[model samples]
Target: EQVKVSKQNFLLGRGERLTDDIVIKGGGGPKEPPYTFGEARRRLSPMVSETSSRIDELPQAACPGDEAVISLTINPEYVAKSFFPHELMRDVGIEVIGSRPKKTVPEKRSRGREPSEVFTTELFARGRRAAIRNWSQQLPDWRSDRGSANALISIEEISAPVPHAKIKGSLPEQGRMALETVLHASELEFSMIQAFAAYLESQGIEADLGHSFFAKGLCFLELDAPVERADDIALFTGVRTLRQMPSLRILRPTVRSADIPTTDLELPTEGPVSEDVRVAIFDGGVPENHALTQWTSRLELPGMLPATEGFLSHGVGVTSAALFGHIDTKVPLPRPYANIDHYRVLDEAPGQDPHKLYEILGRIEGVLSSQEYDFINLSLGPCLPIEDDDVHAWTAVLDDRLSRVSTLAMIAVGNGGEGDSILGLDRVQVPSDCVNALAIGACDTPGKDWQRAPYSSKGPGRSPGLVKPDLVDFGGEFSRPFVVVAPDATPSLTTTGGTSFAAPSVLRLGTGIRAHFGSNLNHLAIRTLLVHTCEEGDQDHKENHKEIGWGRVARSLDDIILCDDDTVRVVYQGEISPAKYIRAAIPVPADPMSGMVTIKATICYKTQTDPHHPGNYTQAGLEVTFRPNDSKYSRNNQVHPNSASFFGSSLPGATEDELRRDAWKWENCLHAVQRKRGSSLINPCFDIHYNARLEGRNFAPPESLSYAMVVSIHAKGVADLYDQVVRQYATQIEPLRPVLEMPIRT
Candidate 1:
């Protein structure tokens, strides 16, 4: 359906005629790509047996005598039957373990189409000699003619037998295994740890539990056992042997402390603060007597020890940056844009218990559920880098919580990016991999000559390479650090540099947007605005692209949302139902003398996550298309000839297919077409279509899945397009006014 465009008279004094035949193509063309029997059979071959005779011809290794953990690939068509895999496993005496959508390399044919996807679930079963063999024998009979009562495609072992000699090298010398285990949230009360402990005791083994975490369907356990008993635990609790094996083990993490340099710069004792926007800072404890304490409400969660001098620096620095704008001792300190609510969750004592770090997840959940805040800043994150195959509990929990709650969480991408080490590059620390969080990396000040801070992390990010550090901000550069108030009564200041400081800078911007927009703006809208305003300078510097995603975000909210005389900016915030599209029409300048018009659009949305499936973590994605009013591109046309040329010109000679693959179909955020004339032989309007899809999932998305889109049109070297559009579509376009600051009360 067409979005209503308000009608208003435009005073077109210039001798330029308006195009009368403006048309909008209604719906997207059929999305399904034609499938062939040969292709389907080839794709299904790895998982499906043709007949009972074929099952008998399987390799001998497929029928192991003892129990094993195996991965079963199921057809996408059969996934809707919720009871299919469970019942089949029960019938076969196999236990269903953790499951994730199988990651398939996108084929050329898969481009521009939402292809049907498949899933692979890890399963544990014993008596494979009997159960699997029997099932294979009866497969032909169960599928008489054309019945699929059984959804089992193919099963392959996931666990490999470790040689007894090599097992010693794999286990710790002290018999301690710092594991990061995952337990189903629903089964937390079942106490799998106790069960495993009992099993170990029966085998004459002794162990000690180090650290454990339980929150919202996730459990992380750390165990210390005798070195000799490691094999038994590995064999018994293996995903192949039992379903209770840890999802991942914390093997030799490269943890480094943030290098905080101290300075004698003194901070102002008082500054202006606004209560209109409330921000929660989750980091090391903020000292109550600190100079910024007057503007901050500090609370220490249960089990948090009193802040020590060393621990106070990181949290205080982060909190100060968040409350007050980036600290520049060269100028008068800027007043805080929002009231602060700080939650202390980190303790950095030497040789502190590792368990405390793991437990921070629960305390964070407590604060998020119990407290109310518009924005949450997590300047503290584990130094461990995330794996492509696994999603850490910290990342999963934050993504789940933030998407459900109204609050937006900004996370630091860690300070591990220093040094010439290969591990330091493109490695975003845990939780920073969180797709929902606004992960920020550090860049040097004066973003125009923007350089990623030597210590700022980079990313191809978690699996499938979703962009991390969604954007960058001026944190501080080498030799020159951001200065902030120290946690001392003397009003002393300190210098620090890291993504930790970078995150709060975004927080400052967020609070400003919230304060200006009031309650009308949502997190997705705020995120859209931030990313939409990001200025990626000098596209020729391709090396810096990944290090500084999208480039540094514009510091001023007014600069992002408000338009100059030649440009008209329109923001759309609403929800789109699953598998549906929403269309908005843009009124082109009526003055044919409008010269060259550039249209840039950005779309951002938050999706419910399936952490187990990091490969397809975002369950929902928005597909957007901008169709200019040109007769050359008809409603039924598959390719827009003008679109190809426009993209080729704007994207530096990119092919039509490459442009379609990168900007239009692949990414969730689409920004394209910067310089096309308004008076070119075409229709007088452009249509923006948003289509939301439930990617790689069997079910539909929830009813209220929100999304925000920002579309701005600029008339280069011509009349004021903003006034013209405002005069023409007064009801449809509402200009965002700059926030007027009230007099500060000291």
Candidate 2:
């Protein structure tokens, strides 16, 4: 009884950092060219002439002085390092916009010839287009030293505008159609789009401008056009893609609620505990009569005029879950940790308005730009599954917005898990693929035998974000439905289920952590802590990685903040400089002991995204190397200690070669655990290298990155391991404490 009480009293690190970054020096050698001069020319010449001829036919209405956009696909061998076609593109009067990774098949199945990146560049005015047409003579010599084959050899193909890559999603058979034009992010290009709209109007094709926004370096124009012109609009020059806009619907689980049972429960009337922490919920509007208005400030969006009863119930259920998790049938309910700002962004008539997707996104963006928040929850997004080649407007804009702020945002991965697997409709939805935020899925229950809910989305997300639903939490099941406050005036409760409620449930856990400790932990630290302490299934099933990534998050604050009998966990929250190496020592006992020891580390960082580059989306990545003992050195090296497999080796996919080359660098979050004999542990630490890129290539003069890492050590035979680690590291580290005391729920 005494030992249990002592362990619960001490919390983990509250941002009282204990270490500084130590720099390291490393070197590498050069590589020989893969493609010869003749082989490269054979592939690139036809593409240039085809693009030049297409540019001549393009209407000068959208481009500035008839300048157009073209794309070049690079071989995979080049994208793994710093080999680009900079000189070749510049000499041809072209300026690059950005690049995205795409699948390719070379003529010969060479060893390193795999799927690679595509660069989007601009061809200058009329004269430059003519210059490119006289290709054999006008283009530089690939054999000459001045016009080296090193860069141009990287090109696999050049893309033209009318390639049938546009026309996305399933289009409605009749009525006004909403088609979005994905144009280049250029001022002159937008003017061309305006003139093109007028030209369409003159041709008797209606093009109602809905909305537009800049994502990274691309422009998205939403227009309500006539259905008859869909085929003609797809062939427009310089327009990258044309697609049907997706609609937003209330997220409901697979199990119908008509047969689900409900029960009444009691609740507390006390207000939120924290004054510093601010949170927001973007969903359908709540009803005027509800029990949570005291801790929640409900506000309608600018154009919200009416509401639906079903939609209102969904909004109330999600908001209620954010305040109080599943109501215990046997235990009393707990009070909210902080107040909420719930913005009603959608209503019943969304189906009638083809432009509702853009309108709702605008309202959400408007609020984010105006107000600063510590936490935000989004239980809704476009009802469309994510794709491999291109990113949707909703995902691009929302990710760009979240990267600029210091807020922890949580989004629900759509309820498409029951869809047809052959068509990939079961994959995670758009905006949930935002690498900057947590895409949450739902578990069927909160007990030890929990499994992924049949309605929760599944994923092998795009490359940089392979592990899709970052974490899972208990939603409702047919037998044990989740409980929420009823829409009536009293504090009565009802049962329901969906990933929508699962999302806010995770947010509630995060807010509770902040409410208990105040400003001691930042958003990045909290994110890392959640990943570190998540409980995975006892069995090792590789396929489960897609179903519930990093397993389910800790259920209660006591489970996260309290110490175990033989284990100790600490957090490091700080910033790392670009293109540099910093080392963090894993805190262990001063002297070695008997029995086996276990070590686990988790690192999470916020990254700037390149929405156009889905495969290479995250701009920043950390390569972590674990060195167990300072005394152990490799036979071939004399300077630094040897590195053992720690982070990348445990992940399901990837060959040994790909893991070391660049695959590990693109992962924004990593977690792994290893157990070793205690005698083998002398002094352990991790070497972290920060790598930054732009458009799938090296980015010079990069900015610093915010990151958080948690490392825990557990000794098999040491019952007092936590106390020993705290005392031995007294010179550098200490336990975290709460800034204020409240009647916290156990």
Highest TM-score against the true fold, candidate = 2
Question: Which stretches in model 2 have alpha-carbon errors above 4 Å?
Answer: 1-4, 14-20, 62-64, 109-128, 140-142, 170-175, 186-189, 198-204, 258-264, 652-661, 742-746
- lDDT of all predictions: 0.57, 0.75
State the lDDT of candidate 2 residue by residue for 533-641, as single tens digits.
8888644676887888788999788777777868888888878888877778887788885799988888888888887566677888899988888899868666668
lDDT of 1 by residue, 1-746 (tens): 87654332211111111212223355445433223334433443433233223323433333233333334544333322232454456655565434443433223232345543223333223334355556554543443122332333323222323324113113345645444445433344445556555666766767666555543333555665566555555544332111112221121112223334445544445544456777888877777676778778888876666776666767787888887656655666766777788887765453345555566777888888786678998876565666655677688777878767777788888776753446444477778887677888888774467678777777757533356767888776645667667666666665666677778888888887777566666777788778777887667765555577667888665576556767666666766665555444555556563566777666667766666545456666554544555555545755442332322223322234324333223234444446666676244332233333332334554575576766666777655666766677555555554344533223
Q: What is the TM-score of each candidate against the true structure?
A: 0.76, 0.93
Instruction: After the best TM-score superposition of candidate 2, give how far the Cα of residue 564 lies from its true spot, in angstroms.
Output: 1.0
Q: Between which residue pairs do clashes occur in model 1? A: 47-153, 69-240, 175-227, 185-217, 629-683
Best by lDDT: 2
